[model samples]
Target chain A: MISEEEVKHIAKLARLGLTDKEVGKFQKELSSILDYFEKLKKIDVSDVEPSSRSFAAENVLRRDEIKEEQSKRNRKLLELAPETKDGYLKVKPIIKFS
Target chain B: MEIKELTIKQAHDGLKKKEFSAAELCKSYLDRISKKNREIFSFLEISEDLAMNQAKEVDEMISSKKEMPLLAGIPCGIKDNMLVEGLKCTAASKILKNYTAPYDATVTKKLKAQNALILGKTNLDEFAMGASTEHSAFGPTKNPNDLSRVPGGSSGGSAAAVAADLSIFALGSDTGGSIRQPSSFCGTVGLKPTYGAVSPYGLIAFASSLDQIGPITKTVEDCKMVFDAIKGKDELDSTSVELSKIAQAKYDLRNVRIGVPKEYFVKGIDPEVEKIIKSAIKKYEDNGVKIEEVSLPHTEYALPCYYIIAPSEASANLARYDGIKYGMSNAGSPASKLLDVYLSTREEGFGPEVRRRIMLGTYALSSGYYDAYYLKAQKVRTRVIDDFNKVFKKVDALFTPVSPILPFKIGEKIEDPLSMYLVDIYTVSVNLAGLPALSMPCGKAGKLPVGLQIIGKRFEEDKILEIGKLYEHF
Candidate 1:
């Protein structure tokens, strides 16, 4: 079972500001969740292939063609934005300038 | 006839006879939306004028004696997760609440090619994270059958809209039974096409590999039409497969085998669900199809494996929402750091369940637990797939309850994440095996609906569709 401290650490890593009440609530919830997952330990999945997709057809081929995206036609696309500057939208800058 | 109740086929025939102009039909749907969507909350935004204009174009094409598009003027609701050019694609999250899509998803492009009138985007659990639409930052969509009950989700809005006849059909993305369960709850036919049968180019990523775009309609025939229009290879999505070229199934039940896993019929399954399923099995027996009780001993492992794998993929797919690329930007940050912008943007943008899943996923994928959890889950996933393959060799298709229980009260399982996760138990294994599945309204448990699932071998959509259509007829 995962500890409350570990849950809190994960919450921080996930950038969530949880109330102590929420953290405590989630601790019990996550423990039960992990305990239920313990059922997987009993199953033997050897010799099985992990399918990445459901369709059997492979090499989904398309004619190689280059097409220009119509960037000029839809200026209304960005009109709903709360902020924009010089063809690029400006908001609180996301990346650290350092 | 009420415009919303008519099937796409019926609507197409109506257009051919010029009984009602496409604009008139669009107006009918709009009228219904204005009347009902306020309470149902099925639609986040409805483009009445835009839909009518598009419908007028379809009318013109019909009058010109031109070839009609398959879904011409058939109104469809797009789940908010899918990007429709110039429309809001918020995925029911505040983070991108007002975000307009820069481009259309390939599925949307295909639907548009058929001149399908897109009515509006439907709400969903934020980023399609939760089973119930309760996690939506916008607000929860109340089930049309019972206002106090939930429309199973994160595709709840789409299912509810279709169930209430708000739209003739709708598009929903299924990541761990989102499409199927909601379809079950809403009493609509929902098909989660073989993964990659439909392109995912414009669907805002939520567990990419498991995510599939499909139709929630009134019937399996409608599903077949929508599937035909949308299924194909697309250059935009490397994962989209060329399914049209695949061979159609030999449609006969005489030699076919249907696998009914014993694990699916065990405790915790509501008696009403079992009653409806037993009746469906009887129909298969009446059709002279063989039914053998099979074993998927690893059935219990599916929930854990799905949680681990889906969230792990979700963590990777959702990494794009870092405030800079797209969506709501965090302004007036308490901290001047870029990481702060990222954290606060996500924290504010995502709803509770989404945040919880992300944190759980991040921890599972963390260095210390990577091998012990994520890798171990992958190994188990392989086993689950093996179990299906071994069973499939003996059975032509598989059958299970779409969900273990009927749609619960709006707040029933929301507080309990495990209970919420348990709802997907029967549906997730199909995804794990990467096989096609269909959910058709078999019967109702009191006022709530139950879906009978038909699982097909990889790329055997035709077989599944045939069986689903047969069962639907019965």
Candidate 2:
């Protein structure tokens, strides 16, 4: 079973601030789910190669030229941001001024 | 006109004959949505203005005596996870509640090119995580056939909308049975096209490797029309490929070989659902089609394998929702630090199931657990793919029940996440192998509909559609 500390650690890793109640709920739920997932260990995969995708695909490259319409679309996207200034998205202060 | 009984083809014919103007048809659907949508909650946002404007364009084209596409003026719904420029695309999550789409999804662009009327966006699970739409932050979409039961999900609203005739056709995305399972429960025809068949650009990322956008319609022919319109290579999505590049073979319906995996018909399935599926296959045999019992031994491991691979991919894909770019943000609250902003915004934005999945994914991909869980799951996935490859050598397609049970009650399995995951047992293997599969209503178990799943080889949508058409006539 997953412990309370482990639950809190996972929530932090996922960048979700869970309440005390949610922590307890996830502790039980995650433990039960992980127990269910233990079924995978029974399969012998020693000789198998891991597959990340169902189909094999090659990398596709395109020209690096910029299009005028894309810049206009980028402006519209910036407008969706909560805070923006001078055609750029504004965010919380990263460096402290102490 | 009875709007509920109209199919896409019928609507096209009616428009061509001037039996009804495109605006008239669009208004009919908008009126129906306004009246019935409140009860089922299938639509999250109704785009009445957009629908009317598109319909007017179709009318202008017709009056000008210009040739029109089959989808011209046919009103449809897009699953909320896909973007429709300038429309509210919340993805049924509070995080995106106020988020308006900045651009059109590739599928939306294709449909717009054909002049298909955009009725609105439908609801889905938050971030397309859960099997039932009950996890939708907006509210659950009840089954049209039986309001007390669930219309299966993450595509629940799309399937329910089509089943309720709120829209003639709708687009849905499938990741580990999101499309096919819900289509089974709702009694609508749904197709999960081969992965990379349709471009994924503009779709809200869930599990990038497994996610596929498909069509949910009232009939197989309508499903095919929508598939043809939205499929092909796109520069925006590198994985996208042209269907013509794949070789195609012609097969007479009578000479086709179909395999029924013995693993799917085992004990946990409802006896009534099994009986219905078996009878449907018997009908094909009666028509001189060859039916064989095949073994896909790794079928049982698919769900466990999917749980790992999908969540691992989802963890990386969803990491972009860090409260900086767009959507909801808590930038300068009690704590003005960037980390604090991410924590507070996500805590308030995500729903319970979404949080649970995000945590599960993060844990699986974290240090010390990667090789054991994620790597092991991917290896099992290779076995699952190998099983399909070996079986396809002997059969043209495979037939199975879409779900083990019928449309379950609304609150039946929501409390138990494991039980909810079991609902996808019969459908996830197809997605794991990146194959095309169709879900069509075969018969009924009591009042609930049972769907027969026709699964085809990778890029063999034509074969499955042909097989689905044969069953439609029977």
Candidate 3:
């Protein structure tokens, strides 16, 4: 079962702040989801190759010609932003890694 | 012409007969949006000027002795994830709420080339992360059928927009059944084209390999029309393929072999859903189409494989939203380093479910768990595709229920992420297998709609469409 502490840990890794109530709630919910996944474990995939992409596409390449025109429109996009400072849109400071 | 309820084909015919102009059709849809969308919350931004201007150009072309394009005069609802030049393309998140795309997605350019009028971008779960649109920073989109219930999600607004007649058709990205599940709930036809059948350029990535843009419309024919206009090779989109230029299918279904996997009809599937799907399968039998019981034995493992693989990709894809260049910046915060800024911004910007997945994804991709989880899931994914390939050798298509249950009440599954994940059980396998699948309303369970899914071989969307159209008639 997914415990309250485990839920809180997952939330912390997710960088979310949750109350005791939310931790308890997600603990129960995530535990049930894990239980449900247990049903999938019953299936035998011993011989199956794990699939990431369903299509058979591989190593697709494009003409790497630098399209200088679209980059020129980048400034036009900044001009449309609701708020900007020092040529960049300004906002509240996010978390900084020490 | 009260062109609000007219099909794309009908609208095209009306434009040709001079009974109504493309501008007139655009105006009617705009008026309808003003009246209906207040309750539906389908469209995020309606471009009155862009739509009318394009409509006027299409009308002028008709008068100037030029041939009308297939989607000419048709107005479509675009999911907010797609970039539309000059429109604020927020993925329904506050982080990029005010951000506008400077250029169009390749699909958007193709639609513009066909003279289609874009109504507006519709709402979605923040960054297309959640199955229920409740994660959207804007607000939850109520199901069009019953406002008390959810319209089945991240693409809920797109499906609801078409269901509520706000637009003729909508384009939605399906990563693990976002488009098809919502279409099933909303009682519209939704298609998840084969991976790379349509270009993904300018589509804000949720999970790059899993994200596929497809059509949600009132009928299969409308879907085929829009698919033709949008599906083609684009130099800008590396994954896109030049799917058969023969856009329309001339093949008949009488000789096609159809499969119904006994495994998908497993226990816990709601009885009402099973009844509806079985009834749909019966229609093919009545048509001279051969039916066989095929086994996608690896079907049950799809959900666990998806949760691991999708979140792993999501964790990597969402790394670009650091507060440094774009989105919400937290520079002045007490946290001193660059990583703190990145974490705090994402913490504040993303909703709970998105965070949960990101964390789950980060865990799966972390050093210790990579082989145990991510690599293992990839191996299982290969098995799922192999299972499909084996089954397809016996049948042209596989029929199944879109979701095990009908649309739940609005708050029913919100507190339970597992329940929400369970909603995509039948759908996750299609994405895992990378096959084309369509969901059409087969019946109603009490008040909500029941969707019958037709799964076709990779790139054989025409067969799925033919079978889906037949089921619609059924």
Candidate 4:
């Protein structure tokens, strides 16, 4: 079962801004859903390996040689930014100092 | 009078014989969309200009007597999620409302190479999250079969478009029955090719591991044609594999072996749907195909396991939608702290179901719960895959219902998330196990349609498609 505080914590971790109504709604709803998940307790999965992917394929890697050609999607990618100045996207500074 | 309701084969034949110009075919579909889309709400955006231009080029190729591709000049609807260069690709979410694709998705590139005419972008559950199209940020797609009922979703619009003859075929991304369930409801054919048989480079990511882009078409032949045109490996999608070299063999319906999973015919399934599926299996049995009762013992665990794994991948895949990237951004908010930007933008941009999944996934993958939830789900996932592998060794394929019930009214299950999640029970296991599956209308429950699903081995879409074609005519 999920607690109200845990719901708030998960919402924050998910970067969602939940109103009081949403918080209350998700609090009740998420618990019921987790209750449904309680069915998983029946399986003895102690020795079973986790399947990270659906089917297996080797991860093919390319040689680490940088081709000097500029990406063709640069202009499009930059345009998708909320705020772009010339060729760069502006962002808030991290690690604020006193 | 109307050039509507033609299959892909017929459309191709007409173009080859010069019975109708590609422009005429394109115009007929665009005209149908203009008239019927007002009610069905199957499309979000119809690009008349682009479709006509593409049709004109096909006309030139036809006039020049060039070797024509199978789908050349054929008009189809694209699910709003897959990108088309210069066309709006919203994934039916408000976040990407004004965003136009900068490049074609691999499937889009394939469709373009054939000079196919794309009618428009179809509506969907926002980010392919919900079972019904009611979750679309725009609005729900009405079932053309019965306007009040929902066209099963998140590929509802694509299915409805094909069912209503708005397009010869449509493309839909199946992440946990998004494509198959909807096609079942709409009384059309939908195929989810093996996980990696088709390239995912351009189809917008939902749950990376389970999502596959496949066709929702009027007929099995069209589904096969569309699959052939779109499936192949690509450098852009690392998970994509070369289309398996299938041995050329005719799958005689009489010789095919089908496993009927007893777990699928459970109490929760609508009695009418169960009756239809039982009769379909009986028909297969009568027709000489070996029919055996099979136990997919872990199927009861599939729904919860999928709810865990899909959302976990979705949480990571969707992290890119933060205000700084290409989609909608509320960075201009009064609370301009970078964190506030992400919170505000996402909270405002995403629909309710999206937010719910994100929160659930964030919780599941969190530090302490990771081993208990996500890891356990994956382990169960291994069990699901093993179940299918063991069954396939005994039978060539499995037969089941696509959805457990008929298409309900739009608002019926939207309020009840668990009930809505239960809608995909019969289809989700295939996605979890990463196998190829197809959904076709078997019979009508009353006024609504019931779907028959045939699932095959990991890369054996051909075997299923061959048998599917036989059953389509049955």
> Against the true structure, whose DockQ is highest?
2
The C-alpha interface RMSD of every prediction is 3.5, 0.9, 4.1, 1.0
Models sorted by lDDT, best on top? 2, 4, 1, 3
Give each candidate's fraction of reference contacts reproduced.
Answer: 0.44, 0.82, 0.47, 0.75
- The C-alpha TM-scores of every prediction are 0.93, 0.98, 0.91, 0.98
Candidate 4 off by > 4 Å: A63-70, B244-253
Q: Let me know the TM-score candidate 1 reaches against the reference structure.
A: 0.93
> In model 2, what are the clashing residue pairs, if there are any?
none
B1-474 per-residue lDDT for model 3 (tens digits): 577667788878988999988888999999999998889898889998999999999999999969999898899999999999989898998778877788999889999999999999999998888777888889888898999899998899999999998999999999999999999999999999998789999999988878899999998999899888889788877888888653653565778788889888988798988988897788778877788888887777888889888988988887777665665666567777655776667767777777677767866676676776788888888888888888877777888899998787888887778778878889998888778899988888777898888898778887788788886675
Evaluated against the true chain A, what TM-score does chain A of model 3 have? 0.67
Our model 4 lands, by Cα RMSD against the true structure, at: 1.5
lDDT of 4 by residue, B1-474 (tens): 478779999999999999999999999898888889999999999999999999999999999999999999999899999999899988888889988998889999999999889989999999999888999999999998899999999999999999999999999999999999999999999999888889988788899989999999988888999999999888878888777555544556567788999999878988989889899888777777789999999999999999999999999888988888778999866775889888888988999999889988998999899998999999999999999989988889999999988999979988888889989898889898889999988899777988899999878888888877877666
Total clashing pairs in model 2 = 0
Native-interface RMSD of candidate 3: 4.1
Compare the candidates by TM-score and give the number of the best one.
2
For model 2, fnat equals 0.82
TM-score of 3: 0.91
Question: Between 3 and 4, whose TM-score is larger?
Answer: 4
Candidate DockQ scores, in order = 0.40, 0.83, 0.37, 0.78
Ranking by DockQ: 2, 4, 1, 3
